[model samples]
Target: MTWNIAHTAFPAEHRRFRAVVGGVDPDAIYRAVHEAGGFRSWDEPSRDLLHLRSTAIEVYRVGDRWVLAVNGPSVEAVREVLRLLGLGADRDVQELKGA
Candidate 1:
């Protein structure tokens, strides 16, 4: 499946980059994130919900999509996680302003 990642610059306390990712299997993505050294910060199996965070990024499910928030202004870290999550080299990324 093609992944659509819409990212924006959101400067907040420890949150610099934010993105919405579509067309992903939450279960597989969770595994990928976990394997990539991300810790489970939140989990609610009754609702099929979870949140994973590493040193630089946090990933969580929202509806049918996954939301990725970078802890700092580390664009490379974002790309790395997406790669680990199985996004192809040819990725569909939409850069937004004030999103």
Candidate 2:
């Protein structure tokens, strides 16, 4: 399955990244995140929250897509989470200003 990374909002605190991933099962993604460690159950029924250092990652499913919202004090921390999610190689990430 191919994963298409869409726009990534900057100002890092916005910490939002969107992707159109198909053919891949969402359960596989959840398993990967959980096995990667530091993931805790989110109060939201279908969301998983991961804390990495000073960064926080929120993973949720939206329709046929997946959204990753990250909140942190630094851009690097946010990028680190993206990398951990195997999304670092996505070259189409448009950095939205004031996001």
Candidate 3:
């Protein structure tokens, strides 16, 4: 299975991989990311934006789906975060594979 991913126009020193997440609680995902040596570098629950440093990831809710953005374009990092969220490998997508 493949998740939808988008590349933002926002410029940074490195690339960001934005992957769509489904069938998961945002709060649970936040806790999981935190427990996995990730710190809440930025968060605005009112706007559904959460950014995790060290882990270099961000998750934001858009309509019915959640978008997971990984700084530095790390597929393994994305996969690891999904795993931490209790999502199986079947949820893996390659939009960020070569980006």
Task: Provide the TM-score for each candidate, comma-separated.
Answer: 0.51, 0.50, 0.54
Candidate 2 regions exceeding 4 Å error are 1-36, 43-45, 89-99
Candidate 3 lDDT at 89 equals 38
Considering every candidate listed, which one attains the maximal lDDT?
A: 3
Cα lDDT computed for each candidate against the true fold: 0.52, 0.56, 0.57
lDDT of 1 at 47: 24
For candidate 1, report its TM-score: 0.51
What is the C-alpha lDDT profile of model 3 across 39-97, one tens digit per residue?
66566862344445434555676777766654435566666666665765355445443
What shift in Å separates residue 28 of candidate 2 from its native position after superposition? Answer: 4.4
In model 1, where do residues sit more than 4 Å from their true spots?
1-15, 45-72, 89-99
Task: Name the lDDT value of residue 99 in candidate 3.
Answer: 44
- lDDT tens digits, residue span 24-98, model 1: 665776687778766555666422333334334445567666655433244444555567767642344334344
| lDDT, model 3, position 13 | 46
Candidate 2 residue-wise lDDT, 1-99, digit = tens? 999999977663554333333333445545656666756556365566666556566667677665666555555656665666666635233343464
Clashing pairs in 3: none
The candidate maximizing TM-score is 3
Q: Give the better candidate number (2 or 3) by TM-score.
A: 3
